[model samples]
Target: MNPFRYERALDVDHAVQAASQGGRFIAGGTNLLDLMKENVERPRRLVDISRLNLDRIEPLSDGGLRIGALARNADLAGHPQVLRQYPLLSSALMAGASPQLRNMATTGGNLMQRTRCYYFYDTATPCNKRSPGSGCGAVGGCTRIHAILGASEHCIAVHPSDMCVAMAALGATINVAGPQGRRTIPFEEFHRLPGDAPQYDNTLGEGELITGVDLPAEGFAGHYSYLKIRDRLSYAFALVSVAAALRLEDDGRIAEARVALGGVAHKPWRLPDAERMLAGETPGSRVFARFADALLEGATGQGDNEFKIELACRAIVRALEQAANGTPQSQVDKRIA
Candidate 1:
């Protein structure tokens, strides 16, 4: 890792001021530290925001919740309020790394974590995301774990956060603090597509520090599931994961739905068309399967991951079915493919 100056921020204002002056904000250090070791991120100065009193998860008056950016993943997942009111978020958080890593990973850090694409991590390889205009190695190399949606020829890397998948499905808002002022960005809009500039991951402006994330009142409480498919049962990045949340009428007709896919795109891939199709329709394999197909309409995989298109479709059905039946898989139970 490169030599860098470290400063502990006394407050949010301190952190923002330091960040605006050309310093990266460090919280959990789960992702940033690793990137630094790989030489992917070389910040000369780091402003520590972990002590900035932004770790609380507060209940909103409107029946929603505000999660501080410094809140740990384990606390967020195991909190009673989260399990009761936002189980989708809970399940998604628990589906991530092991207990030890979860204890150290923060909400904001997870959202800011870079993609796990092999080329991006290996400094020896030519990757556009790693060094813009260098050319993409994954485009013609091994791509089983790359993206199928929202990918350009320059990059095919997929976002690797399971928690953000649920957040996208829940329609959360990201709060950012910067020199200008504080601003809130919709969760879906925060993470950007890998367009011509594949290097930039999100819409966060330079020197903006994430404050917290706001979950809306309508979280689709009871009916939700986070299903992750990986090469192994645990400790592996998702091959294709699905976050499905549904609200059904008393007559078993779907009233509202939110579906997002992970490991398929540069950002959390939400299927608005599939959600629209599920509305007013009964939750069944037939309809879910058709909707899944519709959701994967423009999906095209690289050589090795061609099977992901089909795997994602089936995983979507399974996740939706589990959500509708109110039988979300326990965090400990890993489904082997």
Candidate 2:
């Protein structure tokens, strides 16, 4: 690892100020440390913000939840209120890294973690995301895990955070603090799609520090599920995953639905078209299939990974059905052997 100066932040203001000096903010140091060791990320200074008072989970007056940025992944996932209320979010977090990592990872850091694309991680390979104008290797190289939606000619890497997928489906908002001031960004707009600038993954400006995440308590207070389908049973990234929340009407019809996907896009993919098609529709295989078909329109998959399209669709259908029927456990299998 490269030699670097380390500083511990006394408070939020100090953390933001220290971070503004071209230093990378380190909370859990789960993702950043790994990259630094690999020589993928070389920052001159490291600002340790783990000591800051950003580790609270409070209930909002508007029936929502405010999750602090420094809150550990394990704490948030195992919190009584979160498990009892936002089961989808809890499930997504639990499905992610191991128990040790979950204990060290933070909510803010989880959202900011970079992609797992081999090309992007290996400094030897030319990747636009690592160095703009360097060209993309995953475009024609190993692309089975590449993105199908919101991809650009510059890059097609998938966002690797499972927590963000749940946040997108839950209509969460990001709270940020920077040199200018504080600002709130919708979760959908937090991460940007790879357009011309694949190097920039999020809307956060340089030197901006994420404060926390706000989840609006609207729909899905009752029924919700997060289903991740990967090659391995545990400790593996998803080939395709679905986060769904559904509410049924008195006549057993869908009243409202929020659906978002991961492992298929540059960001968490929300399907408004699918949501619309399922609204007021009965919960059945046919209705779910129709919604899935509408969502998969225009999806371009590589030759080796074309099966992801069908796998993603099936996962979405099963997640919606499980949520609508109040099934706490998913019946879908996760096998690639």
Candidate 3:
């Protein structure tokens, strides 16, 4: 890793001030440290926010929850309020890395996590995200883990966070503070497509630091499923993951539905129109399959990832079925059903 100055922040204001001088904000240092070692992120300074008072997970008067940016993934998954009101988030967190990494990965860090592709991490190859103006190697290189949706000619990288996918499905809001002031960003608008600038992952402004996340009152806790399909049963990134939530009417018809896809796009792939198509419709394979097709529209893969199109469609159907049946995939058991 490169030599860099390290400063421990005393509070939120201190952290933002420290980062205003081109210093990068780091909490938990789980992914940042690895990237530094690989020479992917070489910052002149690192402002540590681990000791800041931003680790609490509290309930809101409106029945929602406000999660601190520094809250560890493990703590957030196990919090009583989270398990009771937002089990989909808990399931996604559990489906992520091992317990040791979870203890060190914070909520804000996960939100700020960068997109990953074979060439982005391999310094020897050309990667537009890693080095702007350098050709995108992922366009023809190993694309098994690359994006299929919202991919531009400049890059085809995919975000690697199970937690973000679930949060997108639940309609979580991001809270941030910067030199300008504090602001809230809707989850759908936080992460953006590659477009022409593949280097910038999200719309977070310069010197802004995420403070917390707001989960709306309706979490669809009773009918939710987080399904991850990876090469291995544990400790591997997903090939295609699905977070499905539903509200069943008293007549057994679908009142509402939400489906967010991971390992398939630059952000948690969600389409409000596809979700609206399921409203007031009957829950069945036909309905869910059509919804999947609508969500996957315009999704053209690079090469090896073409299989992901069908895989994502089937996974979406299976996830929705599990949600409707009230049988969420067990994170501990590692079984499909």
Candidate 4:
């Protein structure tokens, strides 16, 4: 890793102050440190925010929950409130890295985690994300884990955050503090699609520190599912993942439906029209399959990853069926139930 100055932030203000002056914030250091060591990230300075007083998991007045940025993945997954109110998120977190990693990964770090594309991590290859203006090697070279939807000619790397997929389906709001002031960003608007600029991941401006995330009261806790399909069962990044949440009426008709896709694009993918198609309709294989078709309408896959298009469509249908039947996929089972 390149030499860099280190600073331990005393508080939020201190962290923002240190970062606004061209310092990168480090909390949990799960994803950031790895990139640093790989020479992919060579920040001039690192401001440690791990010790900041921002690790609270509290209830909101609107029957929602607020998750602190510093809250560890393991702690958040097993938290009583989270398990009770947002089990979809808990399941998603559990489906991510191993127990050791969950113990160290933090809320903000998970949001800021980079893609796991082989070319992006390999400095020898051309990766637009790592070195802008350089050609995208994943476009034609080994695209097994690249994006299938919302991909541009510039880059096809996919975001690899299970937690984000769940959060997107649950309509979570991200709260951030910056040099100017504090603000809240809608979950869908936080992460951007890689059009021409693949170098940037999210819309987080300079010196903006994610303080916490707020889940709206309507979590669809009664019915939700987080299903991740990976090459390996243990600690493997998803090739296709789906997060589904549905609210059924007393007559077993769907009241509301929310679906978000991960490991398929630069950010968690959600289509409001596809979700709306399920509203006021009875749950069935035909309807869910139609919804999947609508969501993947414009998806085009690169070579070697064309299978992902079919896999994502099927996963979406299965996840929605699980949510509608009140049987979310069990992470321990590892089978498409």
Q: What's the lDDT for candidate 4?
A: 0.94
When 1 and 4 are scored with lDDT, the better candidate is 4
Per-residue lDDT, model 3, residue 185, is 98
Tens digits of per-residue lDDT, candidate 3, 194-273, equal 88898998998888999999999998988999999999999989899999999999998888899999999888999998
- Give per-model CA RMSD: 1.2, 2.1, 0.7, 0.7
Quote model 2's TM-score.
0.96
Cα displacement (angstroms), candidate 3, residue 178, comes to 0.6
Residues 30-141 of candidate 4: C-alpha lDDT, one tens digit per residue: 8998999999999999999999988999999999999999999999999999999899999999999999999999999999989999999999999889999998999878
**Backbone clashes (count) for model 4:** 0
Steric collisions counted per model: 0, 0, 0, 0
Q: Residue 301 in candidate 3 has what lDDT? A: 80
Selected candidate, larger TM-score, 1 vs 2:
1
Q: Candidate 2: where is the Cα deviation over 4 Å?
A: 330-337
* Pairs clashing within candidate 1: none
- How well is each residue in 146-239 modelled by candidate 2, as lDDT tens digits? 8877788899899999899999998899999998999999998999998999999899987899999998877375778788888877788888
How many pairs of residues collide in model 1?
Answer: 0
Instruction: Give candidate 1's whole-model lDDT.
Output: 0.92
